[model samples]
Target: MSRIVYVNGRYLPYAQAGVHVEDRGFQFADGVYEVCEVRGGALVDEGPHLARLGRSLAELAIPEPMSMAALAHVMRETVRRNRVRDGLL
Candidate 1:
């Protein structure tokens, strides 16, 4: 199966993934991200990770790219597509 990556509200083939060169996350290292562990198709420490993300965003005064619910959806979908039973996001 072709790898799918979520980028700017769309999931695309990994080989086709691209981000605007000017996006602050890429250009200025201005962003907050969370990495959660996945096991048996379920996210571990998700709530804490999200809470930390929120804190980081608040501390940096950077707006969240999407709502928590939206991010959760994306994370789950990415894991599902990757068929990852155990991994990190």
Candidate 2:
């Protein structure tokens, strides 16, 4: 079965991970990125994640990805959507 992803405000099917043609991640490689580790259905180190995210944005001069509260919600939902609850912490 296919999974759903919460993108922006929409829960979209995984097969259609679309973005605007002008999105900078692919356009000018203008965005810095991070990979967060998940455990016990939650982020392993969210504090560090946010710190790293902030530093990355600052280094690249990119705007904040989203408000801290909003990013937390999406991170939790992403773990739930991926069904990582059965795994380790």
Candidate 3:
């Protein structure tokens, strides 16, 4: 199965997932990322992880990529599409 990734509000095959060269995250590393573990098909410490992400974005003066609910949906969908039952997301 092709690995799926979420980018810019769309879910695409990993091979098709591309970030713009001018993206701040890629150019200047001006972004924050959270790695949440998945166990038995469920996220671990999801709330804390997201909260920390919000804080990080705030510290960096970056606008939120999406609402919390939307972000959560994206995370869950990505994990489901990738079929990751036990691994880091």
Candidate 4:
């Protein structure tokens, strides 16, 4: 069986997954970041994370890196790739 890792705009094998240097976050650290505890693969403190995301954007006056819908889709794919069933809260 094979797993697909979602990165950037594509699904790739972990070995082939890569992030470009040109990525805005990498280039200028202009994007916000998030790290959550995955418990049994479920996200923990999701509300807080989203709140922080909002605050980060407001503080920097930067648009969100991805639209809400796009972010949800990509995240689902990434979690699927990583096979996380729950996350830390």
Per-candidate clashes come to 0, 0, 0, 16
For residues 1-89, could you state the per-residue lDDT of candidate 1 as single tens digits? 88889998998989999989989888888877678999999999888888899899999999988898789889999999988899899
Model 4 Cα shift for residue 8 (angstroms): 2.2
lDDT of 3: 0.91
Ranking of all predicted structures according to TM-score, beginning with the best and ending with the worst: 3, 1, 2, 4
Error of 2 at 88 (Å): 11
Minimal lDDT window, size 10, model 1: 26-35
Q: What is the C-alpha lDDT of each candidate?
A: 0.90, 0.75, 0.91, 0.70
User: Which wins on lDDT, candidate 1 or candidate 2?
Assistant: 1
Q: What is candidate 1's local distance difference test score?
A: 0.90
- Taking the tens digit of each residue's C-alpha lDDT, what string does model 2 give over 1-89? 57777765787898887887788776886776677777667788788887888888888788886887788788787678778764432
In angstroms, give how far residue 80 of model 3 lies from its true place. 0.9
lDDT of 4 by residue, 1-89 (tens): 46667676778887898779888777887766677676665666656777787788889898776776676567666776678777532
Model 3 reaches what TM-score against the true structure? 0.94
In model 3, pairs of residues that clash are none
Badly placed stretches (over 4 Å) of model 1 are: none
Write the number of the candidate with greater lDDT, choosing between 1 and 3: 3
Instruction: Say which prediction, candidate 2 or candidate 4, comes out ahead on lDDT.
Output: 2
